[model samples]
Target: MREFKTENIEVAYADNTIIKNLSIKIPIGKITTIIGPNGCGKSTLLKAIGRIMKTKNGAIYLDGKNIYELSSKDFARQLAILPQSPIAPEGLTARELVSYGRYAHQKGFGKPSEKDKEIVKWALEVTNLSELSEISVDNMSGGQRQRVWIAMALAQQTDMILLDEPTTYLDVAYQLEVLELLENLNKEHGCTIVMVLHDINMASRYADYLIALKNGNIVGTGTPKEVITKEMLREVYHIEADIMIEERTKKPTCISYRLNNRKIAVEAGIKKGIKVVG
Candidate 1:
């Protein structure tokens, strides 16, 4: 297992800084979900950690060495990132897309070796896409397409996988299917999984650890039982939420929530230069 951590990092887009002085240590071999309201810099943090974007300051370390010091192929061999809504080339079959993951392991000309082919086949089997390997990605359902993308990542044979909102547009059933597959990946193969999720209940149900962010800062980080709370919802989302512990999985669940009018009114009043007494 490898260690991944960021040290006091800052990320910016031109003049606007999105994340400031952030530090995080991703627990190895676990499913970690980053949650917060929109525009909290969750995706920005993921991009930096995945090396898809650069940080303006500080260092990201992989197993004690700075990530910038590693070559692209070397880095890709260790971790794979599946961006949200990845688009495949038209007419590309599931197997064809998965074959691309062998790029880093290949030498010049990047021909698929027998070992690469075998690994790709195994990835398809594990993802339950072996039969659909010949189907064009564009012709598949949303869940199938997502699995194809995941199979591509799996073919990389990385110890860690980073995903951004893997269930964004899927229907509820497909959402559960994807999350269950990820759970199996963690439990069976021991892959470290990190992703950003919009649904608090889904995140709570699937995640072994949760990192909650608000306005570019980490507001809470812990297990679901510790992080998913009424106070956390109030602080991070400005909502009053009812929390419960699921009996089957023993995970925290957010059953109901509504906007906190008093908090909203106070902030609005303060912004308008009114003396508000609570």
Candidate 2:
């Protein structure tokens, strides 16, 4: 299995630093979701780990080697990233876009071998996109297009896949569709899936592990039960939440939440002998 970790990495844009001295180790062959409030560096952290953004400090290691030291093709062979709200090139068909995932495995001139074609076909079929293979991505529904992108990542045949907000803008059904597809990948193929998600309940239900972030710092990381608590919700989200164990998933679920009176909550925690961290 490939080992993935970040060691105290700092990421910045121009003069503004977004992530600072953050570190995380992703569990291999499991689905890990990152959740945080807006502008909390969830996307920035994913981009840095996926090598789409350069970290000004520290290093990201994959399989015991620094990622920056690996050849581009070698890195691509091991990992694939699907960014949020990705736009396909105008008029590109689903099959054509998925075929591009084979580029890293191709030789000079990048001609597709028979094996490459086979893998692409398998990806399309696995994503339930075989019927839509010839359809232009621009013409498809949001859910179908998302699956096409996922099929492209699957075509890469990598052990690890990182996604930023894979469910953004999708309706409830489509969101569950994409998440269930990812769950199947992990369970059946042992693909390591890391993604950023906004839906806290969904994250808890679908993720084997959860990383909670706030203001570029990780507030907690562990199984959903360990991390998704009322205390964490208050500290990370500045909101009062009622959490319960979901019967179906046996994971923590936020039943209801409302605006928090930070001072009152902190004082209440103090009175009840609970450590409150913000």
Candidate 3:
């Protein structure tokens, strides 16, 4: 099992800094969820760790070694990342796309080896795409397409996987379906899963470890019970919410929410030299 730790990393796009100096240690062999508001740099952090986005300052360490020190193939073997919107090449079959995962292991241009073919078949089967394997990715539904991409990542056979908003375009039921599949992958294979989630309730329910971010900064990192508190909701989201516990899962759920008008009213009061009361 490979764990990841970052040290004071700063991620930027052009002149805009999406993530400030941030340090985090993701536990080995557990499902970790990174959650925050829309512009909170959650995806930037995921990409940085996956080496898809470069950090201007500081380093990301995978399995205690600096990630930059590892070769591309070595890094791919240790960790894999799936982005929010992956563009599949037109006319690429699901099986063909999944087979790309084996590229890192292939030597000097030969056809897929027997072991590679076995892995690709296993990935397709595990993702329930055995029949869809020959179908074009463009012809699949959103959920099915997402599963195909996930199958590719699984074929990579990395110890850790990173995904940015794996359930974005799907409906609530499909979202739950995808999350359940990820939970199974983590449990059955002992894979370390890290993902960025926009849904707080879903993140709380499925995550073994939760990391909350705000304004490109860390807010809280712990179990859902510790990070999904009412106070945390107020602080990170500026939303007044009622935190409820699910009966069976015992996971923290936000049953109600309303805008915290206090901030706006307080600022208005200050402008008029009037103190606002709660």
Candidate 4:
């Protein structure tokens, strides 16, 4: 298993810093998720590790070698990133976009060789986009467009995939399907997956390892059983919640939660003679 590790990386937007001196390990071949409130540096940190954003300080290492030392193409071969908003140019077919994933493997003036065509075909089929391969991106729905982008990422055939809010457009069914696909990739191919998720319950449900961030600092990091708790939720999100262990999935599910009206809730709980975290 290839270890993807980050060490004290700092990222900024001009003079304002978004990701502080943060360091975390993305366990090889496991689904590691970064979860945090809005504007809490989740996306920024993902971009830095993907090399989509420059780190103001520190470095990211893959298998003990600094990622910055590798060539652009070399890095692309091992890691692929699917950003939240990927631009699809006008007149670009779904097939054309997925084929772009092969750019790193191409030598000079890539004209789509037999191997490239096969890889593209596999990517489309895996994403269930074979029927839509020739369709214009403009003609597809938001969910279909998102799947097209994911298909392009899959075509890269990397061991690690970094995604930022990958389930933005999908309904409940598609959302579950996409998450299942990620799990299958990890189980079948030993692919290390890292993503940023806003949904606390979804993060807890799908993530094998969870990294919780609050205001550019790590609130906690552990398995869902250890990380998802009433106190952690209260501390991270300032909410009162009832945590329950699901009998079927054995996942911790937060049922009822209310935002930071801590004193009132605490007082009410005390008056009712019940335990509650303020």
Candidate 2 displacement at residue 58 in angstroms: 0.6
**Stretches of candidate 3 exceeding 4 Å from the true structure:** 264-278
lDDT of each: 0.94, 0.93, 0.92, 0.87
Per-residue alpha-carbon lDDT of model 1 for 192-215, expressed as tens digits?
999999999999999999999988
Clashing pairs in 4: none
Q: Write the per-residue lDDT of candidate 4 for residues 1-278, one digit (tens) a residue.
A: 36788888889999999888888888887999998878888998899999989999988999888888999999998999999867799999999999999999999895988999999999898878899999999898777787788778878889889999988767877777778777777787778889988788888888999999877889999999999998888877778899999888798999899887765467568789988862
List clashing residue pairs in candidate 2.
none
- Quote model 1's TM-score: 0.97
Worst 10 residues of 3 by lDDT: 259-268
Clashing pairs in 1: none
The TM-scores of all predictions, comma-separated, are: 0.97, 0.93, 0.94, 0.90
RMSD of each: 1.2, 4.3, 2.4, 5.1
Better of 2 and 4 by lDDT: 2
Error of 4 at 12 (Å): 1.5
Which candidate achieves the best TM-score against the true structure?
1
Over 1-278, each residue of candidate 2 has an lDDT whose tens digit, in order, gives 56899999999999899899998999998999999999999999999988999999999999999999999999999999999999999999999999999999999786899999999999999999999999999999989999999999999999999999998899999999999999999998899999999999999999999999988999999999999998898888888888989787789889899877865578679889997888
**Backbone clash count for every predicted candidate, in the order shown:** 0, 0, 0, 0
In candidate 4, where is summed lDDT lowest over 10 consecutive residues? Answer: 259-268
